[model samples]
Target: MLTQEDNTLLTRTGPGTAMGALFRRFWQPVALSRELPEPDGPPMRLKILGEDLRAFRSTDGTVGLVSPRCPHRGADLFYGRNERNGIRCVYHGWKFGTDGRCQELPTMDSGPAREKAEQNVRLNAYPTREANGFIWSYLGPPGQVPPFPELEFTTVPPSHTYVSKKLQQCNWAQACEGGLDTAHFSFLHMALDDGEDATAKLLTKVSSNTDTVRWMRNDGAPRFTILDHAAGLILGAARRGDPNENYWRISQFLMPNHGLTPNAFPGENYHGQCWVPIDDVSCWIYNYTWNPDRPLSNAERDRFANGSGIHAEVDAHYIPIRRRENEYLLDRNKQKYETYTGIDGVSEQDACIQDSQGLIADRTTEHLGPTDMGIIRFRRLILDSAKALAAGDPPRALNHPAAYKVRGGGAVAPATQSLPEVLQARFGT
Candidate 1:
């Protein structure tokens, strides 16, 4: 169980809190590409990762994220009109651009007086960028925000990409942790289809001091080359005739509030989607369908649409605002959705497990060992750096880039496929 102090570290979104500080270091997705397909109308209101902000594309195709409330009378920016150049606040006719710089004060005389005041007062605006079919915003300190990583999935042809979204009620951290918990894949996504499946169990479990537990590639390869890690992370490069093998699986967490997991199909197809949080407790999972040539098979496409399979029923009853407080206080506390399957026969899959675990986990009480390496390291980075930022220190990952080589540090490669000989011998297909 997490103590009050532990909760303080995890739940607080102030400058130095564990999760908040960590999230501030990256450029997070604020909205989907379709949100601003055209440069028209009032700005779109979006709350991404955790911050409340407004977004809109310019007539010239540039997207901007700015403060939601007017710096003057505190009017909401969503109601403002989008002109060719900037957003004009209907409340006071104060106009501003994507840069958060005040461009005009219609009521004031058109003179240097208005220009001086506008120059002195600037509304907070976050840096915005678009990538992989999503609008991304950097909410952290400008200097510390890291460059987005260049994953191999993005290099594939546009025909391979696909998109989709789902709604959840939970904090961004709770949602993100699901992706890092590699143990759950075998249990949650239980290999109901893989031909050479090793993890078909109904439930997946692990411990810190793993001896009997095998964590390695079946080939007995070098530790660094194999997907052998305590964190349950399995990665490998693409191999010919492999089970949709590629340089990477394209599964990654955007930190704090969002994650991306790409699933590949047999027809040379791929789908990259994102799980975006609606608030501290609710999220919207989105999919960007990248496939342009071949259409998805019925079964393959259905897999993505099944709604976190066996988990949706439990999520229906979740009320984040009410349960948020008690979540952090209990251990072994199954989220309300974790156990609540609707009479219609559905179970809460990933969403319930994380949220019900606690709105915010008491990290100190977490018995993290190896399987949780990714999550553990991620949290530490978040808390420590957030603490540093709170202390007015520079943010970490300030020089983050989209593409960088991972040398000798033992990164996981994508999964491989069973040989044709084995398949023929076993099934005679």
Candidate 2:
């Protein structure tokens, strides 16, 4: 049970809070680097972690994240004038370079005296790195930024990836859980199966987690009694729900933020989920679909963009807002199922199920069951790990160079198979 202090810590968003500080330690994906055109405008406005910031890309394509407000009399830097290598405030014409150093002051005489003053002033800036088509911003101490995870899939050519964003009106935790909860796919997606004969088998397979149950925990926070490989079949949904024996699939959750579901077909058509936190009440879900060889036609893109593709069939579940009798039913249903669903299938297909939870699901009033083992353990992990980080004694990254194959192993193979197969076949699967 969580104490009053723990409960308060969970809800608060401050530097001292466990969650806030833990999140800062990570290099968060702020924006897509491609969003900034090479010859784009001077200063761009970006919002992350509930704070508005001013950013600019150098002519060389380097990005700089800095305080949105100018230091000299506090003008909006977003409106600043853009030069080749720096931005000049529109109000007072004070120029700041990519390094946050004041390069020029239009009002001051151009001489040694002006240079001396400019050298002493520097704008606040966060470290920025561009990788995997995204701009990651490190908000933690300069010395502690962890090495960015090497995502093998993202290493493919630029033409292989298609990206989109889903605006979610919920907390980051809610968005994160949408990916973490594996059991919802069986029911939430059952609507599609109910509507058409073609989808029934696929839906059944997705919902079926009848095999394999293992209890585990990470970071000393929560216990994870997961029904692994349950989500493997759902990856078929992206490829017209193919059930061929030769085909394979996987659903992987990269702890703390993203979800990856990959298809093992002739043409690699992969889907990913990125959770973007925007304060306590809202977040953004960034979706990416990567097809190595088969490029989606404009029509196909439109189908997804217009929500008429597989997304439509999957979204048909959930009660309409006006017809909902109880607001909490959906969340309770989710939490109840997530505890031991035997499989973690996609859950963000519908808003009704999540929105009906009334923003934050209250754990105090809910009943516990053996099946809820997964969610309970997961929550404990977050709470415990977050508390640890909140204290000065920070934990080490789970990546172990010696243990290699067991955890943080860099091997690329189907995750559905057992350890023996993983060892014997290695990359054969």
Candidate 3:
């Protein structure tokens, strides 16, 4: 549990806050590439870290993330025209390029005064890069933009990767804690013991094998071992398997807000998520799945599109169909007789529980246990970094972006093997 002071420092991430300052140092995903599918397309309104912004794709395929207010008369830029490599305010024909440079001021006459105004007038713009189907923006100070972290999904070919986003109605920290806390899988994503046939069917949907499901269900209290690396931490949860085997579900927590799931085995697809704060009370969970070795099949792509694995069944606006307003379409009968949560999808089930923790979880009043070691370590890492930044020292993870190139998944190791041995054998580090 945290003190009230620590909880506030961790949860609140609006501009000028300690946590927000730390987040701005890293590039964040602002929107999916498909949001602005064409050049000179419609501008989209975006709010990240509690600041309202606008995003539009220019004629040359460059994405502009700029302040929404037009400087000329404070008109909302969302109503502007996106054309000819810039956004032109419809009210006064004042145009700004992707770099935020004023391109034209039609209201002014052509003279030295107009030239001076165009040279001095500018809009706040952040640098943007498109990769792995997402448009990422740097919101930090000028000339301090760090290199993009080499996330596996972004490094892979388009044919081998799939990405999607869903709105999570809660503080970003708790939703992120949900991803790092692998111990919850034993109960939160399990099936009721009605019969062997029913258990097998439900297990198939949750895991790659029934044996793994049995191991998770039988051993709810998995022993945890956390290893810190340059980029982040490796969280290993070991549960009892067969006579001499240990079922290790290893997940990765990278820097600020990324978590790689532990469901994959050798030759299987890998999954991950990035929890970006939309505000103090809400967030956007960006989900990605990739197969590094081969192209994903059409069937797999269709399944993901229809909400499989970490991806949610989102509507046209990327809002989960089963959300807080509808009580996640909960079914008490299914909860008692079928699955553990009676939730139709894994993503929905996760969102349901995380949001239930209140808009922002009150860690000060909660009790924690050994199973929460990963969560504890996560808080320490982020809190320490935020504090260090306040002391004029930036996080080391920001400087070592290449160190982010790590994998997280499952491995059946000998019960005697230590966490280091298991990681070495599985990832071959």
Give me the overall lDDT of model 3.
Answer: 0.92
Q: How would you encode candidate 1's per-residue C-alpha lDDT over 1-429 as one tens digit per residue?
A: 335664466556544345565556666566767668888655788776567788888777888788789888899989989997788889889988889899888778967887788887667888888766567777876665565644334444644544444455555555666754443443343322232222212222111211111222222221111232211222222212224432222233433333333223223333333455555556655544434355545664454344322223122222221223443222232222332211111123455466666655555566654445556554555455566766777443344343221111111233443322222332232
Estimate the lDDT of model 2: 0.52
TM-score of 2: 0.70
Off by over 4 Å in 3: 195-199, 202-206
Q: What is the C-alpha lDDT of each candidate?
A: 0.49, 0.52, 0.92
Off by over 4 Å in 1: 1-7, 14-18, 143-145, 191-279, 282-348, 362-429
Query: Top model by TM-score, which number?
Result: 3
Candidate 3 backbone clash number = 0
lDDT of 1: 0.49
Pairwise TM-score winner, candidates 1 and 2: 2
Clashes of 1: 40
Task: Give per-residue CA lDDT, model 2, range 207-289, as digits (tens).
Answer: 22211111011011221233233111111111111122111223455544566642222333556666766676666566666
RMSD of each: 9.6, 8.8, 1.0
Clashes of each: 40, 10, 0
Question: Alpha carbon lDDT of residue 38, candidate 1?
Answer: 85
Best by lDDT: 3
